[model samples]
Target: MHNLTSDLALALEVADAADAVSLAGFNARSFTVERKADKSEVTEIDRATETA
Candidate 1:
């Protein structure tokens, strides 16, 4: 069974992964934005971070 400490660790790990993807994209500043079917903006970094 999972406890609070393990759950928190997993959450932090996921957050770190997401941050790394986002920071890399922000630093590179080369990603293109596209409009989704709903007319919302999204980029490859967004998808990558979500996957992370």
Candidate 2:
């Protein structure tokens, strides 16, 4: 149980880091969602968000 709590905390920290990067990029750019021929939204922000 103690180990489980520690692992959960670590996971939360990683999530926080990812969110910080994503938010920073999102704020730095004007992200526009464009629909493809298949009707899917795509943007450079999406790649940045995932890579971050």
Candidate 3:
């Protein structure tokens, strides 16, 4: 149906936007890994990607 096609297109657009934001942040980060007190690895890229 036309409505179904429209919905799919909108979903695809949103996915594309998210990917752009995530990848942009990923590319801007250093690869240095830092460990937290919780023994978890955290990077600026991770937070940026999640926010994206």
Candidate 4:
């Protein structure tokens, strides 16, 4: 049970970090889009969010 609490807390912290990255990049003036290897459109924001 103690470990569960710690795990949940860690997950929440990670989510917060990811959100910060996404929001920071959300309105980037020079943001661009490109096709991924699978032919899907992706943006700098998406990569930043994932990298967070």
Ranking by TM-score: 1, 4, 2, 3
Off by over 4 Å in 2: 30-52
Better of 2 and 4 by lDDT: 4
lDDT of each: 0.96, 0.76, 0.73, 0.86
lDDT of 4: 0.86
List the pairs of residues colliding in candidate 4: none
Query: TM per model?
Result: 0.90, 0.52, 0.52, 0.77
lDDT tens digits by residue: candidate 3, 1-52: 3699889998888778778876776677645667889999987665555555
lDDT of 2 by residue, 7-48 (tens): 999888878877887787688887777787899887776666
Model 4 C-alpha lDDT per residue in residues 2-52, reported as the tens digit of each score? 689889999999899999988777755578899999999999888888878
**TM-score of model 3 (CA atoms):** 0.52
Question: Which is the better candidate, 2 or 4, if ranked by TM-score?
Answer: 4
lDDT of 4 at 19: 92
TM-score, structure 1 vs. true: 0.90
- Which stretches in model 4 have alpha-carbon errors above 4 Å? none
Local error of candidate 4 at 7, Å?
1.3
Number of colliding residue pairs in each model: 0, 0, 0, 0
Error of 1 at 13 (Å): 0.2
